[model samples]
Target: MNIKFKNFIWGVITLSVISSCDISDNKDVNPADSFLRIYDSHQFDHEIRPVDVTQTADNGYLFLGNYRRDDVDFLGTYISSVDEEGHFIRNTYLRDNNVHPVGKFLVLGGEHYFISMDAVSLQAYLNQVDDSARVVSTIGIGTTYPMYAENDGEDQFVLLSYSSVNRTTVLSLVNADGSITSQSAFGIGAGQEVEEPIIDHFTRTGRELPFFAGRSVDGTYYANGFYNYTLSLLFTDLSDNTPSGVIQGQLDQGGISSLLSLSGDNYAVARFNYGDQYANAIATLNTSGISSSTDIEGNPMLEWAYDEKVKMTTMTLGNADYIIIATTTKNQQIALHFYDNTGAYIAVDYLGFSSPYQLGAIQVTSDNGLAILGSTQVAGKFQRLCLFKKSESELNDLVQ
Candidate 1:
């Protein structure tokens, strides 16, 4: 969940933890006749933008994202599939015209995958979607932000990117019809090499990168990006893709849009805490660092503090454990925030109006309630695609 915007010089746009988990028994079903669903793409100036959501294989509700067509110069990547009240049965557009898409959406064993980045071979594809969302295969990855991926069995998978030729931070091991069986590259300190060390000019000066990837409960394969803007963490070795350590700066500021693993070497970060403005927090890392942190108070974050923008995620309902966040509201609506998992403070919902909304991911449906994909600003200037549900006693009655 890393939803940020402001880079339309026409271009460039870009979860974890477990254990003690058994929070499902709310089979009380009866609150989804339509809990706020809107896939309006606003009639014609098309511009979809949700980045993830899952629960299919019969339970229906997929929704990946990326779209464009304010009348022509198209761009694509979308997959819809709703039901369980949110409507919309099938919607497709996997790779069209100038297909420039990448929004790391996943769902392993039961199928439906995502990761794209190729506008004339900038290479890094890996598509797979059926059950109506079409495009059953795509595969091409010589490297470049596969964005994020994970699934180590039942056919194998693991792809996360950043490697403009070894600038470090790469991993590939696909297969389940997307072959690539093995590959690796990583860097941050010691000798500067993934088996070749020193590549001068300060290690190719590629501005180290990595978006997000996870798996740890002894299986390793962690990654969180940022280099010339600090924030780092890398640890790989899923049997062979070596490179065992690198954990720089522990978020000196911003740059960790989301990451979760929470149970052993604990993890759960959602960043953007510019010291004294644009605040947004939710920390609980491990590997010897941040033990707790929370900041996401009311008044749209301390009264607009500095034009905010945040997006976070984490779910579970019956026995409880949540952390949703999604900020930026003070008339320009879109504020959600529902902590639990010991941090307490259970609810707060306020969605769009006066145009200007942006939440990118949050899912936990199939009766337990809460599905909120993003992008909204209707009629007053297009920009549609918004789905918002909320049940389970209307989100625990906002902590009653």
Candidate 2:
């Protein structure tokens, strides 16, 4: 394992230690002031799997995840606010009368907020939270599943919604105050031949896909997912839900977890090949069409080389893009691989544990640091949230 060290003062550290009575008893697993902070379930026998994180107005971070309490099968939304140095500011759990799994969060009016849904009521809500992890305002948006939501530049948000009953996808415009401005559904007539990219891709004989859409830097929205279990990508104008171009991969039974818009016309996507037992890949999408991913050495992946399932994430620093892939090997060791924008390898770091650990999410903090969150069994018999961070200087050394 290539471990790099940077200057970190120890005197200013204020740690939040978890008690064994509530969660696990093992407390001797500290990482010697390397900027790696792990938070166990100190409050109760529960698990918190973070799904997304955003940089706060004070240059700190707000993490959102799924919180599973003890003796309960339902999972609630969890939020944690931390200082710029990765110190805990506040932690809280948000739940409704039904199942609520938060997908991601965005910053509006210099405040952190997110949209989530309830499984039973099937209604979606926008929650505006304060610095102390308390909800100050709430706005209700009726029954529609948010596939993706992100800032649309001027204190507004653009999101994609999927309607299962009509099997239609809609692009919605939301104001900063959490009100629906307008929604444009994918306007395709039944049995009417349309010459759009997404329409052509989906109209082919295949299984119904839980369609997803993402916006590019220039505000162009594209939809990508499995069409007949094959990878299909398309660009939509969003004016009338009409697609412009389309591309499809030959790989079967694979799905994308996330889509990241790169600096310019290029984009990256994280893929999981269920046909090969959770084997994963990182591919590039552009006007040149789809390109298969390779390692830093340019070697093709026959399988998850580590014999464990892998999850990948992409982020940018300056004008350069990077990817962080977390792999759980056969020995139950959780590891992370760093790569540059071209899919070339950079460096690798190991979490060094003999328990099952699943990667939940990754984020690049405002201070150029890295925040990694996952679920690990090392804390006890069941999984507990494992959160860690590395300083900006140390992260720079990895790619250098």
Candidate 3:
């Protein structure tokens, strides 16, 4: 029996299928202008929603998504490896009825890491794959709240975890041998929990915290209500066993959708309405002093036509100057916008996709291009993976 749920929301059925046309058959056709469509009907039995994609060192692409065999039960997360020509090398599946791998997959060296967080505790696991899609390692970190993982270098990784039980944040450096050297409660805040911590960029001197935007260098943290529209910042000197300061503010009347840092000093936050209409602003902060606050202008970039329910995802590519903002509308259409270092709007591009599809994750590659993963519908089933790339010139043209 097919179970119809809200998760299976269907949109308009329209597919802009681009294909490679044969020059011999049509002399006017340009081979360079050809776009390829690679989809196998037999391989994809049900819906295959792409969660994330990454380019390997060998120039191949790794795609991660969920595979649903039925409307109700047989749902599992899948990872597939495709070559430069989009030829499927191998595919693997992780079947779990309880938790779904909804986040993006991080590929470093030859291993892939993904965060799986559901209603309970957040967990991080390292995935080992053979010639086929076989998971050989599922090493678990027990009860790490708000677990997030990023590649450090080589085969090493850094896992940032927040402990709600202790109200502290822990940074664990993991080696290839699965041994961990941990620094517990590095920041300055006790009785206060740390939210999201990402390795923004590596400096010549050392690694710096790019995720510190809208946060305090003195150990203050800021976040909105999980399901509300309130925004607040709390200060803590968790490094020492001492109490710090707390600052709170309601930056948005609607709801906070996303937050990102510009370089090391400036930051941007997105706010939207509940009805999925367009509305957002970019808030900047200066961290030159011990205590920091939003600029006098409030949100520098405000949009009335921007969809409120549309969640904005951000990524800083190459240098800190180039920031990419990608968002998907309630209609499941994906749009990309680029901003300069000064938080000025630069350019925007639209990736064409049919209905019943939505954008999932965006990642900047080593070459400064983007890897987008999302889901599409095929034969009335709502699970298909799509990947796209835009050159630097194409991105710059959007701003012009």
Winning candidate number (lDDT): 1
Give per-candidate clash totals.
Answer: 5, 1, 18
User: Per-residue alpha-carbon lDDT of model 3 for 1-400, expressed as tens digits?
Assistant: 1211112112244332322223335466432222223333234455666556766666566776666544322235577776644445667655553234434354556666654433233454545544334566665654353233555566665555545555444555566555675333433233212222221111112211212112333323333221111222332323442224322233222334455543343345554433332222345443223222222243323332343222344544434455566666545566676766566677676665444445666756554555566655655553566655443434444555
What's the lDDT for residue 289 in model 2? 42
Best by TM-score: 2
Model 3 segments beyond 4 Å from truth? 1-46, 68-75, 96-99, 102-104, 107-111, 117-123, 130-136, 144-147, 152-180, 183-256, 273-282, 286-321, 353-356, 366-368
Better candidate number, 2 or 3, judged by TM-score: 2
RMSD of each: 20.0, 8.7, 10.1
Candidate 3 accuracy as TM-score: 0.61
> Is 1 or 3 the stronger prediction by lDDT?
1
Query: Model 1 off-target regions past 4 Å?
Result: 1-62, 65-78, 81-85, 95-101, 104-115, 123-143, 146-161, 170-369, 372-388, 397-400
Give per-residue CA lDDT, model 2, range 25-63, as digits (tens).
235422311344445544444566656666667766677
lDDT of 2 at 52: 69
Candidate 1 lDDT trough over 10 residues, lowest sum: 14-23
